[model samples]
Target: MDRKSVVNQILSLLVSAAILAAGTFVFLTLIRKPEQEASANPKPKPPVVRTVPVLEHDGRLDIVVDGIVTPYREIEVAAEVAGKVVYKNEACNGGRFVTKGTLLIRIDPRDYELQAKRLTSQLEQAGANLNELDVEVKNTEELIKLAKDQLDIERKEVNRLAGLIQERIVTDSAMDKAKQAELTSRNSLVRLQNELQLMKTRKTRLRSAKELVATDLELAELSVARTEITAAVDGVVVQDLAEQDSYVQKGSPLFTLEDTSAVEVKCRLRMEELHWLWRQAGSQRSAQAVAADYQIPQTPVTVTYELTGQDGVRYEWQGVLSRYDGLGLDEVTRTVPCRVVVPDPRAVNLVGADAIARPSGAPPALVRGMFVSIQLHIDQPDPLFLVPEPAVQPGKAVWVVRDGVLALVKPLTLIELIERQTEAGDLESHWLVESKTSALTPGDRVVVPPFGVLSAGMAVEEDGTP
Candidate 1:
């Protein structure tokens, strides 16, 4: 009984072991089948990216620059003579216009007048003294002539007496006395000549004194005239330092006036922008002429500004490029300055005497210190392709989508870097490129976002219907 039972158990155990081993082999084969299938035929991975079309167009470029309006001419009026200010024109306060030669200030002229009068009196006295000396000289000259005649008479008498003594008709003592009288007469004549010479010298001194007094009188009169300071130019006073009873020293500033007939705007230009302008101007003028003096051409410019009172409305003015204003390149922005002038900012039209008319709905005056933007129109009419900066790859190449595939292209000419602002106030820089290659043209899509390590001939799926 024991041998039969052991044989049946052993057969059953062998069958169970065979079933378990077959199940394990089937599970392992099933797990390896997926791996082998994956290795044999793999699914392709398509690069997903958004695309934008390249824009090619010929458009007028308006070069824009930020600037501030300033006065065309500024002057500081100064006093030439020291005096107490007695009067000033109403316009001297500020923001008031005055014509040329209009009196702006008047200093006290009493002191100057009194000085002039004193000089005149001194001159008159000098002339009187000169006249008296002239009369005295004439009298002295007559006296000298009389003395000479008397001396001649005394000499004759002395000679006759000596002859008589020699002939024994007179004594030696008498001849000696006659000779002494002749000597005294000669001395008197010499004294008269010296007195005449002294009178002539006195007259010369008096005339010189008169001349000096006359010059002083002229200077005093000039001082009186200078007391009444007048406007040198037709302008509005922007500042006034002199007022009634305000004493000013010589050469002291009295007022600061600006000619408001014209306004100038000082603006800065980037180096690239300046280069573009100079090149355009050089095309018209030879390179030699342009290089000698790179003055900005006298091109028409439109200035736009919004006043604090005007609100959102923009006012525009026409101006011409006048000159370069800055000394050199700015330290911070590396920009040069250019000035543009707008004449007749007032737009005042004279109809008749005491009558004036102005342009209807004209904008406010372009006063000093007004911030503005200047637009210069360039006459370059060439078609250029614009590519977003995001699609621009290194080496002046761009990633373009052609037939839903990636293509790398290096443009022939990259014109400029155009910076514009988005609707959300975000600034965007775009590359203006020109591609002569037929591989790219207008309406060709370019991959923009989701851009990463990509190469030419790479396959990409256009995320949208674009």
Candidate 2:
């Protein structure tokens, strides 16, 4: 009975195992069919990328740099003549504006006037002495002439006496006396000639003395005028060291006037920025001229100061690239220091998106110590294509998409990297590159961000491409 029962149980187990194996085989076949179909019709997806159109740039590059405002001219007014300040104009106070030639201070002119009067008296005395010498010289010349005539007459008389003696009409003693008189008259004429020479020498001394007195008088008069200190330019007094009743010595500082008519912006430029500027200047000037001077071109620039707490509101003033501030690059910054001069510091334009929305008032003047942004409007020598900064890879290459394929442009002639403020007041950077390379065109699409394993001639699909 046990054997029969064991045989039946084994048969049932075998049947169950066969059924389970069949079900497993069926499940494998179903999965394998779909896998083989997929392997036979393979569809590889291409890498997706973002693209931006390469736009043609206007032949102008704006190099924006940070700068600080400075006065075009700072004049330290010093006392030319030492005296007590008897009067000081109200405009001579600190922070006051003064027009050119405005009286700023008056040193005690009474002492200068007295000194001038003494010099004048000395000059008059010298003039009188010269006149007297002239009169004396004239008298001496007349006396010499009269003495010569007398000598001639005495000689004639001696000759007449000699002739009478020869004719027995006169004695030998009378002839001798006439000869002696002629000798005496000759001595008198020689004395008068010596006196005339002495008078001429005296006149020369008197003339020299007169000239010296005249010079002294001129200097004295100048000192008198200098006692009244006047403003040398239309400027604002930033310092006032001299006050009424204060005594000042020669060369003492009285005030400091900053020229308000114009202002200078002190800025620094990198080597690349200077290269573009120099290249543009070289095109307009002769090679010889450039070599001789080698100066920075006076390119027009806009000096802008963003208003605090005012979104997108900037005060802009027109200026020119005046000159290099120093002879070489700055030691700490390794940049060339330059200056931009605004002819009118008060002439300001409210610029920006929110400029029109802001309240109207007097725009602040471009004074010293104001941090500003200077935009140098430089004209490029050639046309360039603008590409987004992210599109430019390291080593100056850009990925261009054409016909659903990616092409790598290597060794692009990058002119500059510029930043512009968008309408949303956000700054975006772009690369300005020369279009002469032929790798990039105005209408070409450039791959931007979210880059994958990029290779030349790789199949790529634009994100928005159909």
lDDT of 1 at 163: 79
Q: After superposition, how far is residue 219 of candidate 1 from its true place, in Å?
A: 3.4
Error of 1 at 118 (Å): 2.3
Error of 1 at 210 (Å): 2.8
For each candidate in turn, the TM-score is 0.57, 0.85
Please give, for residues 1-466, the per-residue lDDT of candidate 2 as tens digits.
6999999999999999999999999999998998899889978888989888888886588888999998999999899999999999999999999999999899998887998899899989988988988898899889888998999899899878877898899988888889999999999999988888898888889899889888988888999999999998999999999889989999999999999999999999999899888878877887466443646778999999876678767888999998988688889989999999999998888887667743565356889999999999998777888888998889998899899998888888886788866668788888888787657777899898888788988998898722
Tens digits of per-residue lDDT, candidate 1, 354-410, equal 223333553557888889888876654345677788877667777777876778877
lDDT of each: 0.79, 0.87
Q: Evaluated with TM-score, which candidate comes out highest?
A: 2
In model 1, what are the clashing residue pairs, if there are any? none
What TM-score does candidate 1 get on C-alpha atoms?
Answer: 0.57
**What range of 10 consecutive residues in model 2 has the weakest lDDT sum?**
286-295
Model 1 stretches astray by more than 4 angstroms: 1-63, 78-86, 138-193, 196-201, 241-254, 274-302, 306-326, 341-343, 347-361, 375-466
